[model samples]
Target: MPHAEAVALSGHKILAVGTTSEIEALAGPSTRRIDGMGNTLLPGFVESHLHVFSGAYGRKLLQLAPITGRDALHKAVRQFSDANPDEGLLIGQGTPYGILEEDGPITRQKLDEMEPVRPLILMAFDFHTAWANTPALKAAGLFNGRDVGPGNEVVVDQEGLATGELREKNAYLPVLNLRTSGGREMLGMSGDEPETPPSAQERADDIAVLKEGLRYCAAQGITAVHNMDGNRYMMELLREIELEGEMACRVEVPYHFTEGKPLPILEEASRMSADFNSDMLKSGRVKIFVDGVLESGTAYMLDDYANAPGWKGDPIFDTEAFAKAAIEIDRRGLQISVHAIGDGAVRIVLDGYEAAQKANGARDSRHRIEHIEVYHPDDLPRFAELGVIASMQPQHPPGTLGLPLEPGISAIGRARWPYAYAWRDIVDTGTAYCFSSDWPIVAVEPLIGLQATQIRTPWADDMPDQRVSLHEALEGYTWRGAYASFMEDRTGRIRPGMLADLVLLGGDIEAVVPDAFPALGPVLTICDGKITFEA
Candidate 1:
């Protein structure tokens, strides 16, 4: 773990950590040498949070992140539609909330102007909201608002027609299913496997997408991924990929627990945990969504939003139900990871975790709260007290990593700016945490993430600086991330006997300015002692 000139890999574990001369003496003729070229090498990146299947499939969709203004939006949509003429549905990813110059709320009319005929749905960058054209809304039968359960809405106008603004997963899922892949990639978010089995061709297509995603991760120097959304079918697909000897990154999936699912569903989660308890692919965690995101005015906040004064957002689960489920999940010994973005949601989840501890005595649960974008200053210490891991995305903070500031900052209100994405505050409280990209929401590039964390600018002159040190950020994506996922012994650090999951950067990360970190990427990536990528 100390600073060494070189580290040697043998089979699937580190053979030696020493000076270059010392390690060279142990190398056999068959050993392949990798020249660092004055670049830095360290443990491979561990993506602490991401939706791999969705991120993979999203790559096939038209990206709207680069396109701007109404003219560009229409051009991009028209081009994408023309290219995929026969495709059942046209979907766009990374659609900005403020795509239009004058935006009240993005209506179906805006998307209709872009691509009127084909069912078009532009998903917001955060994946919490989406805009669907009239055809898409009709195709999904959401033209007339249907009850989409709690915390989800098919927003309708004064005339009772859908406004095209679909909030949260439940509302937009029907529209998503219109795609050819049957939206199996996101079925896991609702804690459901495909209603019926896929045909052989469909299965093959899904496998191919998974392969693409894994390869993409490998290229980014990600040796391990803690997938935030998935189901049994996804696990099976990953297992098949592993068997085919094509798995480029180690993956850990969770049993998604949605609102309507009964407590007995925890039994199914337990089964999943037992079934896929391997090093390559594992399932020993439960994922739950306590609220939606702030951008869409849906994140359950403690107080009214700055824009919408009367509205405080919605909670996905009833307080008692979530507490009970948390207790049961804890009792069953599954690690719990909840998606909670607002201060209100953060409090509820913290209370639920505390309830679980009271009911089922404490163990090293290492329970995680994904995306603590905003939290009450008083509840800050609970993360450490309850032993919760702050699973966060450095790219998510508004104004960092090219994210816009208005919508997210306004949602939190000016009064709470100090508590929003308070990375430094969380760390100072002695709470364990890790950083991630939350891929497809952003790109799955750790170096970009490192830069975002280090170069984060304060919202106001008086606000506390939230930037973390370069080494601390690196550990978040490596050692600390492994520790969060319970894979510390197997992967995190560069030491003798640790698994040879390593990344060699193109240039020394410390030598460059913070802004230049994004340009520095993996020259070589090795996972399980196999050269997964070499540039």
Candidate 2:
């Protein structure tokens, strides 16, 4: 258990972990042997946060990450439209903020110029904002701005016509509904079940899409995925896959308690917790969004933005409302995971957790704060004090992982630079934290994520170095992630009695440099004693 050179698996569980000779002694004649070929073998990576279902479907959409100017955009749109002639709505994913250099704001007219007739929608990299063409807006009934709820906006012009800039999920849900899949991809984020249940054939298609996503995760050496968004419909699909014995990864779904939903809706979360409690497909967690992302200025900051005067940001729930909901969820014995990006939102989520502890009395809730991108120094220690987990994505930091620095850095301001995506500070405080990709928002590659943490540098020389050691980085993606998801006792370590979830890297992780990590991938991935991926 201290440091083993070999591990033996038998029937979906580790039989022994010891020196090569000791492990070999335990093997029988019928045992299948695998040679690592000097590659490093580790517990399979646990993705702590991601939207698996939608990310799978997003693979088919046109990617705008590589495009820079109008000419390129026009060509890409035209080509995509031509390629998918039967598709009703043309959707583009990973469109960066300020993609159009000459833009005031991304207006419907500008998008119309790119694709005049076919309806088109471009999703921002953060997934917090979207821009639709005039046709798309008209088709979705956003031509005349409709009141999208609190903490969401549909940008409109002086004459009260939609401008195609939609701020949050509610603002864009209508346009997304025009997709060929009927917006089923976003139903988890919207915290709604399908209004009309899918037919038998439709169910089969949905299952296939999820199967592809699971296969993708397996290929990435991901044995466990903590989906940040979900409803019963998604869980049902996963359950079906599990029953069919085709599930490749361990999936943990959460019930998303979106804004405007009644507090009693948490009962559904309890129901899910009871219905699917298997290790492969389980749900006993509730997810909520306290605020949006920093890039869009929807992040609830503690103080006014450096650029925008008197404007901090909007919060999905106030302190009282959030605390009340937290108490009830905690009392029901369910873990809570809230999306809190800005310092203000982080503080609110922390306050709500503390309130839950005070009201329900403390238990091993293992409640988590997702995306603590910006943290207030004053509230840093609460993570350890309240036994909360900091579920973070290393790829989300600006200046690394293809993310632009301006909007996020300027949004947080100079005074708060020391705390923005401050991984080192949080780790030093002895707080429990885990790493993830927040996939589709960022690529779901654990090695890339580990490289980001190892190679990350501060925005300025005056700021503290936020880079973490390789061991810490690995811990964040493996055991720490397993602990965060309540699977530490089952998997996360290549030890005897643990689940047979392991990944054989293409090269020795200890000997490789950070720059070459992207080139190195999983040569073999095993889950539940089955070889899930082999390269």
Candidate 3:
């Protein structure tokens, strides 16, 4: 059997897997063995896409304000400010509208009276929007009539004054920098520096945060994580961690191409790719952000948002430019992962991939489309036709549900709704799919994501029609996740010759009620022949 509860198993890879007595015959006197203690053993989970560092740091930085209503958020900010009198600024992240009572947008004036002296910046649950105080705006030099950046907008009042709400990076970047810089200074003063090289510290912190996130993942039986954020410093930090032998889980780092930039970074990325040792840390592919998110109304929609008419989502790069970049990257023998959320963005990404395929002929580039949330019905089959991997986050649908599904799902209509997660549909078409937490945006628990996949309804919604089978959900987190990161050969499965990464579940998932799977927590997580977590 691939996974067995009782064990006296030992080897670089799985030497023998069976019942305790059956496998004990192969063990020598010095064979190291671990008792499952009645836990259900399974292959270690793999996360297809996640911001490891950001998720880790978010745990320590700000409080998540429940967007129950305007009053609840206002009260939370006021209470937080009151609790930290000496704190320079108030920072809050992950404020989703599903929890809010107000249907309209949130404005900065709501919190003006709470603590105007200190700057405050609160990120929306989507991370695509920001609510900033006047002082914080001024600090970012966003006063007067300055334009934010492309794909971002400043929420202004009828009087043309800033309303404290910013959408996308255009408006959020300025304030985000201020918050990050300020947080860094605060961290520096606390003498809690975890790594070195001033330029590399941010990247190192991300890795440190990711390492901590791994603990949470391990608790859920995740043995491998595919990091999609690409930065020079991040690659270096990964190398440092691997050199020190501190890397417990397998990681595949993909480089992302910056918007409006040439493919020159690909050469540098290739150099880094050379440094990647497939043993533990490996360089898998390159990433590109073709569009924004659907919830924030910046996801580059073909049609306008149903709730907010006359607004089509923004595309980070025009179709021609995006296609050109894809061809160049693909031509260089590098795999590509594009972020396409809206239907329009999805169409654009597919067109680009098709163009790349036509130009370069068929190859095993394994180009993937990240966050394929809204897809044009016509484009669904093309994913499998082109051999593309749909790296999706199951938590998004449940987490962002209840927001007038029109703009995101209704735009595509009922026929496509059945294929939202579309795992069964996509697999039927021969396409590979995977699941991830997209942590920091959502929790990094693979089990939670698996729970969400099995039970598509958000925490508040008790709908049963949206649920999928428990077996399908687990495969998305395991084999599919490994395939998305190109680690299927060594990490996703528990077969012989594969890495000995596995997790011990508190209960047998197959025996649990389908609806009650979320309650099944992980008891132990093993990675690369090492036990990283036990609880």
Candidate 4:
């Protein structure tokens, strides 16, 4: 590729690419000029995986990013709760694992000491772990402890009382369910439709929330998104935006499937794919959670945790159950993405993909594994062999972002240190890869994430080296992501006949230092040949 100068758009497609005058000559009447103003231009970013509705809603809640001290957390909660006394609950986002080291492991007594009367929950940055106050637990019926499925747990004290720490969704659903308005939005669920239909004002408000999220993504140079959480409600919301001609990005929504559901339920997924197929809104994929995360020690590991002997984390699905689900989805010809965060989970998903191939005869299934935080060496090559896409997030912050390595790295055991977050190792294996922010868990800005992937300094001389070049990192966020979703032909690149989804930065990207990427902004954003944003 050469250093290009200009591009001309015809309706929703790129018409020509060349020098400024060469492009201008191809432009016809009624075509508006969008000046670059001496800024860099690139294909608008493809946000690979994120929860759209929840990320937008988190902006209105208590944020605790970059806070570690016990006293700091206490003060933040008090200040937020005091200012918003009318709020139904006090929920905060972005608490890192390091906080446990500073304040000791969080417990019911610890949370009660901070504020016993009010219901409060501090969700971990991973969204896999939560610390609920006594009120929140009691309200959810976990006060005396409830037996949940394989991977879910309600941490309890030695005396058999419930601790404040809640592992996975079922552990803390009660606290999250209390929100009357915009509550379902936070959970990224649309299953429970209201018995009473929403008024026009409420519908408008819901649309506003969706628009706000899409606009935010555009400002960050994102013109396409594979929203990880999905349901008919989410699809309809995006459909409404497309109907109104307000959509500024292409979306690939999925039908989230839970374990133990009958195979017949897949009929709805097929119908969804047929009914909602469009350039703007589409759904034909299925999302599954095969395991939890490493932060809470629930990430389903192949070996026992260094901190806990004879206890490897459990998978949400056992071998036979997952194999059955994979065969059904594969037989339906739908793409699937599994949330496998540990080596054990990763191996099972790989095996399931392999079994699906053996049963149905091989095809370009392109199944995916989200958050390969750690993996076993034997399973590394299977990704390329099985044609699985490794979807990862760069702003995860713990691996090379200077956060304390306690609990996580140590818990994984020194023997498995090399296997944790090995980006270079995975990329070297010829496996397909894509990057995302997983916003509502981390910052959605790609440049900020680029800093960690392209310029992260290892925590120690002995830690594994996993540095990726800036060009490769950008590709992970753009063309590669498009390829993963089968949209490479229409939107990933700036070429003739492709959708005019492009972004203009304020300066030459190649000349800027990787660390300074956070300072860069998308000065102009054009999506589907429409000017959606200008700085």
Model 1 C-alpha RMSD to native: 1.2
Q: Model 3: residues >4 Å from true position, as ranges?
A: 1-11, 65-67, 82-88, 98-100, 180-208, 398-421, 457-467
lDDT value, residue 287 of candidate 4: 89
Cα displacement (Å) at residue 205, model 3: 5.5
User: Which residues of candidate 1, in runs, are more than 4 Å off?
Assistant: 181-187
lDDT of each: 0.90, 0.90, 0.69, 0.82
Candidate 3: clashing pairs of residues = 67-99, 67-100, 95-125, 149-170, 300-313
lDDT of 2: 0.90
lDDT of 4 by residue, 220-339 (tens): 888988988777766777888999999977888888887656778888888888888888889889888988877688989999988888988888887788888899899999999989
Per-residue error (Å), model 3, residue 42 = 1.2
Among all windows of 10 consecutive residues in model 4, the one with the lowest summed lDDT is 186-195
Stretches of candidate 4 off by over 4 Å are 189-202, 397-399, 462-464
Q: Which scores better on TM-score, 1 or 4? A: 1
Give the least accurate 10-residue stretch of model 3, judged by summed lDDT: 185-194
